[model samples]
Target: MVLKLRSDFFHSVLLDEEKCKGCTHCIRRCPVEAIRVKGGKAKIDEELCIDCGECIRTCPNHAKYAQTDSMDDTLQRFKYSIALPAPAFYPQFQPNISVGKLLDGLLKLGFHEVFEVARGAEILAEEIKKYLSLKNIPKPVISSACPAVVRLIEEKFPSLTGTLLPLDTPLGIAARIARMRAMEKGYRSEDIGVFFVTPCPAKVTEVRQSSDDVGRIDGAISISQVYSRIMNMLDELEEQKSLQFSSWKGIGWARSGGEQESLNEGEYVAVDGIHDVMSVFEKIEMGELSGILYCEAQACVGGCIGGVLAVQNPFLSKVNVQQLVKRYPEYHLLDDREGKELVREGVFRRRRPFQARDVLKLDTDYRKALEKYQVIEHILENLPGLDCGACGSPTCRALAEDVVREKAQEIDCPFLLREKMLELSREIFDLASKVPQTMNEERGKQTIESNQDSGTATGESGS
Candidate 1:
């Protein structure tokens, strides 16, 4: 299939058509059913995709990948550049590697300066506590830290969009601070490039399509892209830069439950893995989770450490993060007074409200959508309901919707196709059983009458 890439929206998650086998693995695993196998290739619906990197994680053929910036290109683009590494980055290395050593290694990779995203997380954490203290804001304010989860809510759970914490992500906050510091050092704003060493594709998307005017990132580089380079420079570093400024709380954001831990609250629930997060969101929509005051949701299984762009195994990375967290003191870039000042400045808050995506609607017109929905229900009743993905849709209902939308036929379902074939076979057998009218007439009338008389005599004798 010649997949048509969307021009209207930017997505980091993409497909390698040459590597795709059309095995339906990604379509089945995609939480939003954004993928479909068409004409022996996988196609991604850019609008529905959340850039969660689930397709990248599940593709056995390594067909799916995340598009990220090249380090060489990033370095050459600007006079000054800063590296904003996620909290998850620290855990990708051996536990023995000090955070300061990692910062020094980044400097070797052509970055003039390195800023920790964890410091942004620490600042944001303080701001979050203050926000939580406010009354009538909304119950169970969801964390907006995970860009993928935030997009997922926008696409699939739009009603809960209001519940999302209207705050800038750590990467955004870090990029903003890095830019300000660079400007203070005599670098022009346009000459300073802020690039994030991202752990996931979603962050890359966040950097590419950020709506924030203050904290715009120039580009995003995946951790996997620079892992080998960093590894090569680890031993040759001449000096440690004392670059470790973020505390244990900030660094802990790499793992599950770390956000809630920073809040120092017990009423909040931290859910990791995209599917589990969706399950909790469903409960919240049903009003079953009213007692909870906050929700920390991460799209990746072990939080950011489990992102597909990371090099190490997530479980091992989690342990590394836990060990690394213990080594750092509870130091923060911003004191309480400074944090409150920034909060008052609205530096950490989102400029625009989170809006819902209408990608899931069957039609733009309400009456037409209702008609299509009824058609889908009627078609779904006949489907096998196995959700086998053989029809190139994630579920039977999805196939039915596709049929209504003219993207597929009802016979796409193997069970329905088999029934159609059987029905045709029965019709053929019935047609073959009939004698030609000419042949029936050619047989003498006396022969037909004699056969009937013989049947009647046999019946009378048996009685």
Candidate 2:
């Protein structure tokens, strides 16, 4: 199959040309071969990247960045816009800044209305609880909330796709409800735009990659972008009007264990960060993490508040979210009528599994794969396992894979190829070191003359 580049599939961690030193650390570490060194800089191949935030954490130069939508885009789409702020956003502001002050800041930024994504979290918790009550599916349901984790299953672990929790993400569900309420107030659906205040790049990728069943969310604004705008408003804050906010259960989604707590299920384990999530998923795949009802995996460590794209200190956000949650009741009931309708309409739908790419040459032709595999094995056997990445490939295994694809050669290995060249040079020097000897008639003539002269002298002496 032709490897078509899907730019929409992923977003870049903004790579600053000035900061990059051409180190391939990110390129080498990426599970998918998404990073490419081009023109002395690391460039992300959007089609291959999953926006797992690995590159952001790994880049020593801090050059990687994610794109955010301008507020103008949201304002231009509709006469009125609703700011569907993620719970992670709360921590970016001061601890004393009430939710009402936060809402007022959103209004100052031109949002006609403001809604907490936490409320949407409450709805999701209820739905998950109902799902648990019914014993239809397999044990250890993987959380569908994390787009990166979901994509990982789609690409590397397709067999586990069925186990992914089939539900709309908190942001999507929240956006849906916000739009529904806006429409109930006699606002035109087309005129009302809902923008998600996102904490990570993965959420942006999710909105683009997932099917358009969750239609209410028009766009995403990164926390970093909104932080400055909100900060400016905070500077001018004096007397803030009071507004009723959603329950803490809705806002708890910014944290790692928020989802499980929202559902109040004792059988679930909440995990954060990509590496830890991968480890847990591995256990699930191995049938070791069974008997558990749900596995809430967040790719960003410490959950959404700790997302690479977020502006606040993750720890501070965690504390702020906890304080915010403490202010409201632990559990709040969602008017389930709209949520049930959304489920029946198939609007709030789960992403389906896409077919994996035939990366193996064997899938194309076994005979060709066999030939290539032999060549690859020979090259690997001679290679250094150091994975130094001097050959422009990530590791020895990657070089082997590239060799199979005819993209690289065995001589690309510096040490082994250098040694072979040294050996050949020594052999050539030995062959040239041999001296040629000649035996000639002139040598015999000289020896005969000397013997005659010596004999004549001896005869004269005797006389």
Candidate 3:
């Protein structure tokens, strides 16, 4: 079983307690149930977190943030660093900026060279086309681009493991190509670094991992983190049109339906947004979604443009990406020859395919875990079942599970606490009504003697 230790999880996404108001927005918004409210604070379970960046997007307090490499720090790591900007980064301006402008911006930032990850997307798309054309590719072969979506399948929807297409992501392909290009220029491999201008925490986590081919990329910079720096240099535009490689076909990859376009087939569905992807995957698991050759599941809504770290409004950014696509020619800079040669050499392939994370394995002993699950179910039956979120859980059943596992107390539920308080009040009132045993006996005797004395006095007066 592939299991992730909590200690080994990347801390790209972190919560600022001082800024967090414990509003429960983040906990409830989390797709994987990785977050919980505790002690008036939001706590993230590292073992369960997929680094989706949804919490960062949803948090009104701006408490959630991602740690990314800065310009100074990133440049210092290599004698020559290459910038690989995502296609989504292209649409920051209204007129829809040229790819040349973006590449030039990276050059000004001290990168010896700039590569459009979009170009990589085009090559990967070509490879995917060849794979799909072979028709040997599995029905509903899912895209391997978005790390968050891939991790989601690994963690939550393990049943759909067969649906994942065994292809390296464009980012991974681009990194290898960039290194190869640098080596051709007589630079040592160790001296050249590839820094991705990323848009989400998933990419950051991907870059940090040594195992992921895409992760092997030297480092990453979040778009929002470096937006100001790039913006400052935007007005001083130096267009290196010759250096530009990706076309509008590559730019089509910036949004949700672009991959479907790349496939050149209408018999596919592209689902964007984490929740939508989850719902669609559930249908796929149930064998409800049929007749689709490919499934493109992107974690961010409106595709990569809707990533959490984006400074531009997602809707506007999305428009910008679309405009860039329509204005430029489709296959102007797609390098089929070199891309295929690299693919043939297994340059863009992984040693082993991704496996499901053993998130459901609560214990090594099956019998013990089964017994514990039974107890949790029984505890769940007694819960209020309102899923109020007041108990720091998304659902009453979740709280029951937590209580059974001893991770939380029953009193954490407001309804349960009120019942307990009422029961304690009744016990206190009953105790107050009764005296101590000896004191009660003495009081009883005095009452009887007083009654007898009163009767005798009445009799004597009558006589």
Candidate 4:
């Protein structure tokens, strides 16, 4: 496939060049190989990067960070701002606090209204279960909730593209519902902006997808940034509503198995963490996991709770999810009628298929690419073969590929430069040895004798 770079996409994950030490930490840790150190600083390839925040987690210098909308500034643009907090947002507060209190906290923090993304998760469950029952799709239908996972599939596992579920994610559904409710309140669509309180930069990238006319939310605020601010405000808030707005199944979305729990039928396989998702995706691609009906892959280890930007311990946050589910183990009336009407009205429209990225392709031309591949292979043969990050590439072969692309040179490899220096030193010694030993030993004495003879001849001429 000839993959095109998504120049239109906005990446919240940015590099502060002044702070980067160029330690090769991000390049080594990035799952998609999307990061490269160029000119003594780390740079992200927007097309290849999934915004998983791996670089943010790995950078010791704090050079890699996420840029999100300032909530204070975001509120000024709209008369009514709805805060759509992700399920991951729940665990950041004190565990004893009620879900209603959390929503109240949002209201206290300046939002006119607040909506649980979990409510959207519950609504999405019905649609996915329906799709699985009727469609003759490939097995192991992957979840699209995590934008990082969806982008990863598009870039690294194109063969499994058909396996991706067609449904929009919980946040997408929540945004739609939030806006609908706002419009019902007499707020103009343009006047009300929906903001997502997100745990990762991936959500920021997803909101930026609005440029393609597919975006649901207006902006995203970093969860870490929102957490401390909200926690400070929680003490002054009072619960103005009740937890009856959402169901226990929706709350389950904070963890790995939560999505499958919302479904009534079909065998389920749920995995979290980017590395684990990659392993499971590879199996699905090989048709090894065909018996499974659904595969929910969360980019973070404990689902959204494990986001790199999160301040809370992921395990502790997961405990909070379980506690919330145990305490609120009740479902709101199906509102089956509303869900059906939504389905009829295309409220939960499918997402556009992600275009596969040709990250592995070296060149656009067939013959030229073939020639470059061969050259890359030849360069690889001369490398040390250790996948060391010293030269800034992840592997020897990667460096060779970069060299072939003229992005780097063999001299960039310290080991290769050392070898060249040793060879030159040997050559110099070998050339010096060509001087006869007698001539070499008498060279200093001969020089002194010539000088003395010149002086004696000058004295005789003067006499």
Among the numbered candidates, top lDDT falls to 1
Error of model 4, residue 323, in angstroms? 0.4
lDDT on C-alpha atoms for all candidate structures: 0.87, 0.75, 0.80, 0.82
- For candidate 3, give the lDDT of residue 282: 92
How well is each residue in 1-463 modelled by candidate 2, as lDDT tens digits?
Answer: 5445463445735677888877888888776666766557887765557788888878998878776688877788898799888888887776678777787788888898877787777777777887777777876888888877877767666667878777777777777667777888998888888888888888877655544433546788888888888787787653344434567777788889988878753788889987788788888889987889988989888998888878888888899888888876645444468556877766456544444444334436788778777877887888988888766677887788777776667677778789889999999998776433234355455545665877553322221
lDDT of 4 by residue, 260-362 (tens): 9889877999999998899988888888999999999999899988887677888989998888888877777557788787777566776556666667778
Sort the candidates on TM-score, descending order: 1, 4, 3, 2
Tell me the alpha-carbon RMSD of every candidate: 5.1, 8.0, 5.4, 6.5
lDDT winner, 2 or 3: 3
- What global local distance difference test value does model 3 have? 0.80
Mark the 10 consecutive residues where model 4 has the least summed lDDT: 454-463
How well does candidate 4 match the true structure, expressed as C-alpha RMSD? 6.5
Model 4 steric clash pairs: none
By TM-score, the best candidate is 1
For candidate 1, write residues 1-463 as lDDT tens digits: 2233343278999999999999988999999999988898999987789999999999999999999999999999999999999999999999788888888888888999999999899888877888888899878899999989998998899999999998888887888778877888998888888999999999998888764354778999999888889888777765474677887889999988889878855698999999999999999999888788889999999999999999999999999998988888666557678666666756697754577877788898999999999999999999999999998988999899999989899998889999999999999999897665446554445455665877653322121
* Candidate 3 segments exceeding 4 Å error: 1-8, 135-137, 210-215, 333-337, 435-463
Instruction: Judging by lDDT, tell me the better candidate of 3 and 4.
Output: 4
* Model 4 Cα shift for residue 321 (angstroms): 0.7
Look at candidate 3 and give me any clashing residue pairs. Answer: none
lDDT of 3 by residue, 3-37 (tens): 55543577688999999988878877889888889
